[model samples]
Target chain A: MARIDLVDLAHSYDGGNADPSSFALKPTSMTWRQGGAYALLGPSGCGKTTLLNIISGIVKPSRGKVLFDGRDVMALTTQQRNIAQVFQFPVIYDTMTVGENLAFPLKNRGVGRAEIDARVHEIAKLLDLVPQLDRKASRLTADAKQKISLGRGLVRADVAAVLFDEPLTVIDPALKWELRSKLKVLHRALDLTMIYVTHDQTEALTFADTVVVMHEGSVVQTGTPEELFLRPDHTFVGYFIGSPGMNVLPAEVEGRQARIAGHELSLARSYGGLPPGARIEVGIRPEFVSLAAAAPGLLAARIERIDDLGRSRFAHVRVGDLKIAARVPRGLSLGGNEAGLIFEPAHIHVYADQRRVEGAA
Target chain B: MEKIPNQKAWLLVLPVFAIVAFSAVIPLMTVVNYSVQDTFGNNKFFWNGVGWYQELLDPSTELGGRFFASLWRNLAFSGAVLAIQIPLGIIVALAMPREGWGVAFSLVVLALPLLIPWNVVGTIWQIFGRSDIGLMGWGLNRLGFDYNYVANPIDAWLTIIIMDVWHWSSLVALLCYAGLKSIPEAYYQAASIDGASRWAVFTAIQLPKMRHVLVIAILLRFMDSFMIYTEPFVVTGGGPGNSTTFLSIELVKLALGQFDLGKAAAMSIVYMLIIIIVCWVFFTVMTNAGADRKGAGGER
Candidate 1:
């Protein structure tokens, strides 16, 4: 295993650099530390799979250099790179038994019989495929076949890295969690650097040490799960990473003071030298907002709707044509249409042009 | 209390029954009738009982020996065609263009031979194999080989086999192409990631997935080759000491040339029975193989 560095990588399916719309992946650079579980997370058509394919040597980037342990591998084929990848759909040799399927990579590499057998058996045991080792892969259930797909990758010890492209998509819902936990355990036990590509936020957050969130062919943010939740680098990350995402409202900023919907508010940080002509906004998660009984230092608003989520309630309120959501604790006795909505200074974040304003949290 | 059953469902099957009886059963009954009875001049009938069948089945009798010889010939021809065509078809299918306008162009080119009528195919090869003016015959003669299909039995057999291969191999290739197209791209991607060679990919992914289509192609080629008469009859007329006389040609000769209706009818029935039984056996074996693989219940 080795650390992977992507140097100014960009890809265009049409092979043209003039039209940005044709670019599948925008130019960007990042590093994945060795033995670290990193997730490339995004919605569909967000370049996550493109990034994974470029790293796996399946698709050469239009212009970039991929360095594995600082050695450029752009010209190497997938076989030459020796990376193992599991696809969205399980791919196993239908004619081969589970044991043979797991031993395929090693056999291709011309490993000895005894060593291949040992590695196959070890991986089979780890994947809970010991009982079905003698059975043909075509006869197995979808989840079991997926396990074999994973096992084949794990059986080869000389692989540079293991890549997963939505490998759990075909798995049953109840079995998804079980398989995900098993993947986590395998990553830990094998100490292999793995890059998992998925669109599901829960899967990315739960599986990766660092989650790279992409939007519109560009990397929007890359941070730990806690860091992403607490401080999003971009507005897309703030909205994409959380359910009932952070509420953004247009605001005017002057030094340590901000004005929103004709209500003056005190800022926790100053944006003294703001960029000219940049749009200013205030962002706050619903969990940090609270309803109050008409008090100073709070904005007056009309409650539009309340969704009771058993443990907590989401109160969607309107303040001067702007809708803001507030998560209220249970038994708060919120009944009236008119109430005061308070934004916690510590949790409120200021953004200029969709990017987080430095020192303006 | 017993409920009244809906009797209307029976009427829905009436049209199918009528069609089957009219098209198949009636013609088959006429053949069966002819098999058990003898006819003299002006339709004067005599009770033949099992005499014709017994004579045709006994190897000591001339009729029986001819029937068995032609039967063996038919089987060998079918076996050779299947053995050669199936693999050749798969290779052609693999080599066909996969996508874009080239795919359409290749498909049209590949389908050209299959679209030719069987009789026309025979006629084309018949002239094409002439030593004087035909390309293949003149080419072979020029290469210092005395290749005369009309006068030589071995040459006739070779010509017929090659003619049949050219006429039907495209059907098998098209079926295999359809099978290949049905496979998802993920399988190929995974195979590449697994470091599988081209041969391994074919054996593991392409071959296994093409099993159902291959079975269909085998059955079709077997049946067509076994009953083959028109092409070979038009080309060689079962010449050169009856070496190329297959079962259908021999049956036609017995009924039409020699006016042995009873014996021809019996042979026809036997041929039909053999084809049915062999096809049934093939279908059963293939379907059972499919079930056995999936029946192991690897889920648990």
Candidate 2:
């Protein structure tokens, strides 16, 4: 296993002359620890694939070096880098049997026949594919074929890392869960550094120990799933992660309090001398905010709708012209549209220019 | 939903039925009619049931001897053409540029030979093979070879075989190119990441993916070369003492050249049956080979 490092790596499909905003991936440096499960999460065309390709040595970056285990590998081809990639669709050799497909990488590297057989058997057993080892890979279902793809990547013992490019896209929905958990189990058992690229939040959050969220050609945040949910470093992260997302409202902030639609709210920390004329806002998760009957001590809002999501209920409320979502406590009933929103002071984060701003305590 | 058996749906096929009758049935019926009857100068046809067939099948007779010789010649010609064209076509397809303006440029150039009329191709090669004037023939003769297609049977055969390969391999190449194009970019990326060698990728990925197109290429080249007449007829005219005469040329010489309708009709019927049976067998074998892997182990 190797720790992959990107030193100021970036890519522009139009070559280096393109504007910064047009780049497929922006200049950034990060390090992936050895044997860590990392996910590059982003929407389509958000440069997650571009970053993965750079790591796998498939696409050379316009700037910066890629270091593997403290060695510069910028000039290496994908094969020379010795990384394994599982594609979004299963790419099995149609003419080969399952055992042969699993043994392909080993055979390509000129491993001993006995060793190849042993590795293939080990991977097949781990993947529960032993029964179909002799069957033609082309005749299997998509999920089974994807399992073979995974097995091929894992069969090689000396791979630097295994990269997955949304490998479960073609699988049946019911099988995605099984294959996902299987991947987690494989990671723990094999102790391989794996990078999973996907746009699905649940897939990234559940599969990766560290999730890197990218938006519009750059990384917005990189942290643990709980860290991302609890404290988003960028406004985009706060908006992209949570269900119904963290509610963001245009507000005015002073030393110890904030004003949203002319109502004052207390802050746990002090914000002194905020940047002149910055577009300031407040962000808080729905789980940290709740609704109560209109009271003098709370910020007044009109409840627009209530969503009952089996486990909990969330109230979509409007304070003046700004829409906000807050939790509806169990057994709490509202007789009319009027209600008040209670925000947890510690969970309220401030933003200026879409980047999170820390306040002085 | 309840199923309804509609008889009127059969009437909806009337146009197709009429079209097939006019295009295929009526003309084939004429050949069958002539095969069974003997016709004289006054258009007087006498019943001559299977006499022509018996004479044609019996090798002791002139017609049978001629038929067998031309049949063997046709088979050999087809076999050589396929053996040469399929591999050559695949190589050419692989060499083709994958992107940018070069793709369109190469495709158009490759299709030029296929666009030429068969007779034109024959005439071009016929003149192009003349020892005294043509560039190829003069060049070979200068290189100290007596390369005259007119007098030498071997030279005549070589010229026709080379000419056919030049004119038809592009069709196979184009089909293979299309098959290669349909493979996703991900497959190549995955292969590279797996550290596959170039030849291994060709054998394990390219060849298997090109199987369907190769089948088409083989069948087309086989039938087209087996029934070949125009190009070789124009170039050789079945010359050098009938050494290069194929089945089609011989059949045409029998019916139109010597006015032997009954024997020609019998040969034509047999020829049609041969083409049908061969193509049917070929298609079945190809499809079966592809699907055999699924035997009792179909999709989960």
Candidate 3:
């Protein structure tokens, strides 16, 4: 296992002369500790896959150094780098049985036949593929095929890391959870550095120890699931992590007060020296904001709709022209369309130009 | 749900039957009729029974000797053609550009030979292999090798084989190229990540992926080479010593050259049966091998 470092890594499918803004992967630097489970989370064309490919050495970055264990590996091919990658679709040798598929990496590396067999069986057992050891990999279900793909990745003991490029995309819905948890289990048992690239938040949130949220080719935030939900560094992170997402509204900010739609909300922290002419906004999670009966101090809103999500209800409220999501308190009777929103002072975050501002508490 | 028996469904299949009857069945029947009868120049025929078949099957008889010799020649020719073409085609396919403007240029150039008419291919090679006028023959002789396709049997065989390979190797290559194109980029990436070498990638991934197409290429090449008559016949006209007389050439000689209608019809029928049977056996074996693996996996 190796700690992977991306030292100002950047890439553009077009050559070096291309404009910096058009790069598929914008300049970024981050380090992943050995044996850490990390997920690169982003929507399609957000450069997550490009980043993953760069890590795996499938695509060479146009700039920057990739260091493994503090050694620059720019000239190393993927095989020389000793990384394993499972693709979005299951990629197994159709002519080979599951056992042979698992043994492929070892065999290619000229590992002893006995050791290859042992490793194959061990990986197969871990993947619950012992019964399918001799069966053709091509004829297996998509989930099983993905499992075989995973098994192949895990068979080699000396691999620096195993990279997954949305490996569970083709799995059945019911099987996705099973395979996902299986991956989590494998990560624990094998103690290999696993970097999973996916757009699905649940997959990222559940599988990763630290989730790196990306937007438009740049990493917006890198934090644990709770941290991402509680304190998103960027507006994209806040809007992407939570179910209803953090409700962001165009606002005017001064000191600890944020005025939205001509109404004021107090802040727990004092904000000073705000960037001039920046697009200022206030973000609050729906879980923190509560719907109440129209009160004098509360911000007035028109309840557009209430979504009953079993454990809780969120009222989609319109405050002036701005729409906001506020939690509907249990055991409260609503008499009319008009309601008031109470934004929890501690939960409110100030943003300028789509990036969170750190205020003095 | 109750079943509805509609007899009109069979009527929908009438066009297929009519087409098959006119295109295949009636012509085949005419051959079958001719195979069992003796016919003269006047078209007056008499039942010859299996007398012609018996003579054709017995190697001691003149008809049997000629048939066996030509059949062996056809088999050898097909074997040689397959042995050379399959690997050459695969190599060419591999060497082809995977992308860019070069891909279009390569594809067009590769298809040029296959687009030529069979007789035209024959004529081109016939002159091309001439010691007096052709570049290849003139060049070879000038380089101190006595090469004359018109006079030497080995030279004649080599020329025809080379001609056949040139004319048809592109078809196999094109088919293999198509097979290679269908493989997702992920497979190669996965193989590379697996630490597979070039040979390992070819054997473990590419070769297996191209199995279906390779089977088609082999079958087509085998059938076409086995029944080949046009090119070699044009080039050598069965040669100075009947050296290039393949089965089709022999059959044509018997039917048109010698006017032996009974023997030629029987020979053509036998040739058709051999092709059908060989193709059936080959197809069955390949498909079953694929099926066996699927069956062994068992459903989830």
Candidate 4:
């Protein structure tokens, strides 16, 4: 396995140097470590597939160098790079039996017959496809075909890496979890570097040790799932990672004090000499916002609606013109139309110009 | 509770039944009637029973020998056409442009011959194969090959085969091209990533996916070539001592040229049965091969 490095990579579909609006993938640099399970997470058209293709050498980047283990591989074809890619749709030779499908890559590389047979059998057993080894691949269910796709990649022992581009999209919902866990088991058992591209946050968070979140053709944050959940690097990350997302309120900041809707609030960190025209906001997760009795620094809001969510409840409240969602524990009784909302000091984050400010405790 | 059968569905099907009766059954019955009896010019018919059928089946008789010879010729012509056209068509289809303005232009050009009527195609080839005025014949003669389709049996056969190829190869090519286009880009991409060579990709992916279309092309070409008449009739009139006389030409010569009604009727029935049996065999073999590959899932 080899570590993949993308240096100043960018892609424009129109064949000209692209402006921000036209570029399919914005210029950026990142490195994927060997034997690491990583996910490129984003919505549709967010360039996750483009980035995956670039890494796999399927698409030549318009401007960049791709290095495999510090060796420049920009001129190498996909075959020369020796990377295996599984597509969104399962692609198998319909005429071939499952055994032959798994053996195809090895055979293409001119591996010996006995070795090819051995590898095919090993992979088939790992995928629980031993019984289907003699059956034609065209006759299988979609998930089974996808398993053959995965098996073909795994059958090659000398591949640099295995890349998946939304490979679970065609699988049934109940089978998705089983295949996902099977992927994780294979990754651990084989110790191959795997890069999965998907638009589903749950798939990314559960599958990858390090998840890279992209928004609008650029990466917004790359971190462990816990870090992303706790401290999002950009406002998009905060709004994208959680169920109800974070509540952001417009604010004006000066030195150690911030004012929101004419109420002065104490700051967790100092913002000395802030830019003159920079828009500022306070971001807090709904889970961290608490309901409290009247207290100093607590903001009063009118509770518009309360939704019971079995183990917890969501209190939709309005403070002046701003709407906020606060997740409160079940059985917490509150009678009035108005309640004091308290922001947990350690959980509160500040953003300036849509990026998290540094020194926010 | 026992449910009453709905008999009114027959009324709904009556129109189709009437159409088939008028179009197929009545004419076939007339042929059968002619096959079993002897008829003169004044509507006087006498029972012939199986006399004409026995005469047609007996190889010692002149008509039986001619029928067998013509049948063999028809089979050979169809076999040669299929052997040449199927591979040539696939190659042409593969060479066709995949996208952009070139695709539309190439498709229209390839489809030009198919849009022409059968008589027009015959007349065009008839004039085009003449030694005095035709390009191919004049060019070959100028090159010192002594080519004349009217006088030489081999030259006449060659001219007819070439004309048939030119007229119908495009149909096969168009069908194959459609099949090739339906393949997803992902299959090729995956093949490339697997380090498959060009020939491997063709055999493994392209050929397997085009199997159904190829079956259709084969069946159409086989039936059409076996019953071919107009072009050869126009070009050579089954000339050079009946060297190129196929089953259809021989049947027409019997029915219309000589007015031998009973023998012609028997030959027509035999010809129809042969076409049906051959087509059924081809369809069954190809479909069974496909089903074997696709029936594995049902086995579970």
Candidate 5:
């Protein structure tokens, strides 16, 4: 168990010899505390997995240093780093028995045969794979293969951290729930520093204790799941962390209020840096939007379409020139008439150039 | 289902099956016809009626002496190739990159030898193994070992073996490379987090993951090696007194040079049967492995 610190690590795939624009990951610093379950969540090509690989010593930073337990590992190989990583697709050996696959690391390290057997038995039992020890790994279903992948990753007792890069993506849809919960149990039982990378919001939110929201090669925010959902530090985090995402609208700020779609919404807090007519926007989660028949509140919106999302209904609405989503409780009688969009004033967030400007008042 | 009959699907398989079957059927039928009868110079035929089979077992037939010797040589050659290629190919595959520029570069370089024709590889090596022009021969001759592919049996065998390694190790390498490539990067991540050593990653993750491809590689290499004629023949002409004469080269000598059509036919049938049996053994091992993993029936 070790704490990983990435210090001002900037990685450039473009050789970094030409220009400053060649950098993929600009100099960024962050820390993952020991035993913390962190997920690097971002869209594809956003450098979430790249950052994780860099942390794991698969990709070294072109500048700065990566520290594990306060020791610089800039010149270390992945083997020297001793990081366990699970890829998006299952990577278990097909030829070996499931038992052998699980016990591989122990065997490789020259653990006693009896001890290896016990550890393999324990892990297989924990993974509900006790009955499959004798079976070759290739014939197992995709889920079982993935479980072996996880089991192999967890076999070693002295690993620095366990890094999962979209490990659940290849699992059958029905088995994703069970395997994810198994990983959580293994994490708790072992208390290893685990960093999972995924673009799936629900998986990131549910599986990780702390979510590190990354966008375009930089960490936008890292906080507990609730903190991420409730108060995102950046516009990307706001849009990325929520299902249907947060609704963002162009706005003009004056005094204590922000005007959006030709109407004003009260700001909970004021920012001294943002200019009056600057490129400003107000953001709120779709889940917080209250539907109305025909009245004025924050602004008026036209219900374009209603999407039934089981527990809630997302009314695809048009707020002036912008299309925004307002999630109402399932079976709300929303009409095509100008429906007033109401949100708690304290929940409103104002952004200037993709950075948060208005604080909660 | 009637509305969308899978005609397009068959379009994909038709070309491959056609090419494979057409190439296999004619020569096989000729071998079969020759196996059942004896032919003379004027095309006079006599019914042999399993005489060659009795001779094959009796060890008294003129066919058995040179034939069995080459058969043993072929088996030994296949064993030696397997002992060297699989582990070496896998190591090369592991050292290569999973993606990016390194991937394409490694692939192109590794694929170079596999693209050369069998005869060309033999010719290239034959020249390269010469004491005069080839560095290997020059170096060997410089050391006064008296290495010559044309005269010495051991040297011919060694040259053929080296030439075989050079020509075909790449196929195994490329196959294993493809296998290694197909492994999801997730496995490496899993291995890394497990605190597995690099060796553990290769043995547990890389080797196990490459089983199917390695099996295919082995089978293809085995069958190809078993049927090997062109390379060894071009290099040693099955000479240096039969040191490098494999089963196929012997079959060719019998059928083409000596005109022993009936014996050649019988041997070809026996050769085909041996190939079939070896292929079956590999198939059995692979299928059983696959079945044991599945936790159910072996049926596809």
Candidate 6:
């Protein structure tokens, strides 16, 4: 079992920057438990890759403490860190035989030749690369090359954690899904700590036990996939973790009612002490929103457009000047002019500034 | 759906092929004609079948042994240049920073020597090695030794080797530098995460990755050195007898100095054949190495 603790970590490509604007990753702290498949999920330039690189020792953080199993690894080189990283593009030696590339890391660690062969074949078999073991990497297809790269990382069982940095970006869609599932299964069987960095919510949700949602250069939210989807603490996580994203509309809140386009929605009876004049935002997952004919419901919105994505439907509704998207089940024709929208009080997340406020008072 | 027939594209390239053939084939035919004929002054000619080839291969002939010796020196010179240049090039490339002002700075400095023309490089070395006026020669002489390249064969050889190293070593370094630069930063990252030592990074990753460029650098240096003439000819004039008279210098001595075009043309063909054979061996070695990496990936 391996546990990693990162403390006060920040990085800037430029030597010294007193301001956060000059830094790529803001100062942050985190602890990852052993055998947990955690993912750093964010868009490009969100510092997920930078954080992964820092953890792997490829990138040295400007100010930080990186501890693997309670031992500080910040000053240690990448080799000393004892991590395995797979990059966006496959990086196997093109001249080396597949078997050779897989065997190399083992031999470098001074593993016996017989043991190296045994481990290489075992990992190759797991990755479905046994048939191509003798072929040159240059002659292999893109998918095969990436498998060799994956095998190289997996061949060594002693590493603290396996870090993946968008390793499936170059692979085809079918292979991508298969490979993602394979990683999940392998993590379960081996019980190794895995940190996968990806911008795709589906991959993060499926492959990671804990999804750390990052935006700009800061960690916005970190929880299980269900926790993130059902209760996003930050507006960025709300928008980033779901398809059709959660619809965030401006509102005026006073006491128990939140007014939107002159239509006020009552908060739960429990919330009674929200501070006044705070910039209030109402967030509701598209899947939770339902259209009703009644007027005393949550809010009033005009149906702007409807997008059909096979099994589910997305209705873009206009609430005053703001647009909110609601995910509707199949076989429902959303009318244009005036439609009542309702959400369970539990799913209606209220926010002050960008941070989530407690159940609306 | 009706099938679309494939059209011939070579018809579009016919004129380019004709022009290339007209220019190259005619000149090669002239050389081949000269290689098999005996011609004295006044354009007098007699049929000489395999005459020059036989004389050059014959050990008893004076000029024959000279041809073999010159060829040997040419081969040895190419080997020496490869042994020194390729590894030196890789070292310089590795030491060069990946990006920023340093890379730009190193690039400009490396480019400076390559910009000098071959003959101009020879002229500069020739002047720089003069005993009376040149810095290196005068400095060496002042240390109490005869260091005259014009008279001494050993001095001339050293000068030529140094001149070649200075003039062309930059090219090998630059090619290797490009190869090294093209390697993705991720490979180093992977090696680092693998806990690969510095020597392992160089041996397993850097050196193997530079194999393609290394082969190219060797081929370029070999071909160029095997046909080297201008620099050594301009610097030492193949002087102090035939010590520095490589195949190209000897060819010139036969065709221009003695006006024996028949013998010179025959030697030129033999020289071309040697280069082709050596280049073939190099290609074979590289292809086998590439082939050995088979089955590492999927269906090729």
User: Across residues A32-92, which tens digit of lDDT does each residue of candidate 2 receive?
Assistant: 9989999998889999999999989889889898999999999899999989999888898
Candidate ranking under TM-score, highest first, comes to: 2, 3, 1, 4, 6, 5
Docking class of 4: medium
Candidate 4 C-alpha lDDT tens digits along A1-361? 9998989988887764657577888888999999999999988999989898887778888888889999999889889999999999989998899999999999999999999988898889888999999988888877899999989888887778999999999888898898898889989988899999998888999899999999888899999999999999888898888877888889988766778788777777877766568888888899988765545668988888987777778889989999999977656677777788877766777788888887633
List RMSD in Å for every model shown. Answer: 2.0, 1.9, 1.9, 2.6, 5.1, 3.4
Question: What docking tier does model 2 reach?
Answer: medium
Candidate 1 off by > 4 Å:
A294-297, B292-300
Which pairs, if any, clash in model 3? none
The local lDDT score (0 to 100) that residue A329 gets in candidate 1 is: 61
Runs with alpha carbons beyond 4 Å of true place in candidate 4: A261-265, A291-297, A302-312, A336-339, B1-11, B292-300
DockQ of candidate 3 against the true complex: 0.57
What is the C-alpha local distance difference test score of candidate 5?
A: 0.81
Candidate 5 local Cα displacement, residue A122, angstroms = 4.6
Candidate 3 CAPRI grade: medium
Model 6 chain B worst lDDT run, 10 consecutive residues: B291-300
Point out the higher-scoring one by TM-score: 4 or 5: 4
Off by over 4 Å in 5: A17-22, A109-122, A185-187, A268-273, A296-298, A308-310, A327-336, A358-361, B1-48, B61-70, B73-142, B146-152, B159-178, B192-199, B213-265, B291-300
| Deviation from native of the Cα of residue B172 in model 5, angstroms | 4.2
Correct interface contacts retained, every candidate: 0.79, 0.70, 0.70, 0.70, 0.52, 0.56
Q: Give the C-alpha miss distance for residue B66 in model 2, angstroms.
A: 0.8
The Cα local distance difference test for each model comes to: 0.90, 0.92, 0.92, 0.88, 0.81, 0.85
Compared with the true structure, the alpha-carbon lDDT of candidate 1 equals 0.90
List DockQ, one per candidate, in order: 0.60, 0.60, 0.57, 0.53, 0.36, 0.44
Q: Is the docking of candidate 6 incorrect, acceptable, medium or high quality?
A: acceptable
TM-score of model 2 (CA atoms): 0.97
| Predicted structure 5, TM vs. truth | 0.81
Please provide, for model 1 over A139-207, each residue's C-alpha lDDT reduced to its tens digit, 9 standing for 90 to 100.
888788889998887888877899999988988889888888888998999899989999998999999
TM-score of chain B of 2: 0.94
Candidate 4 residue B7 C-alpha distance from true site, Å:
7.2
For model 4, residues B139-253, the per-residue Cα lDDT tens digits are 8888899999899999988888888889999999999999999999889989989999999999999999999999999999999999998888888888888999999899999
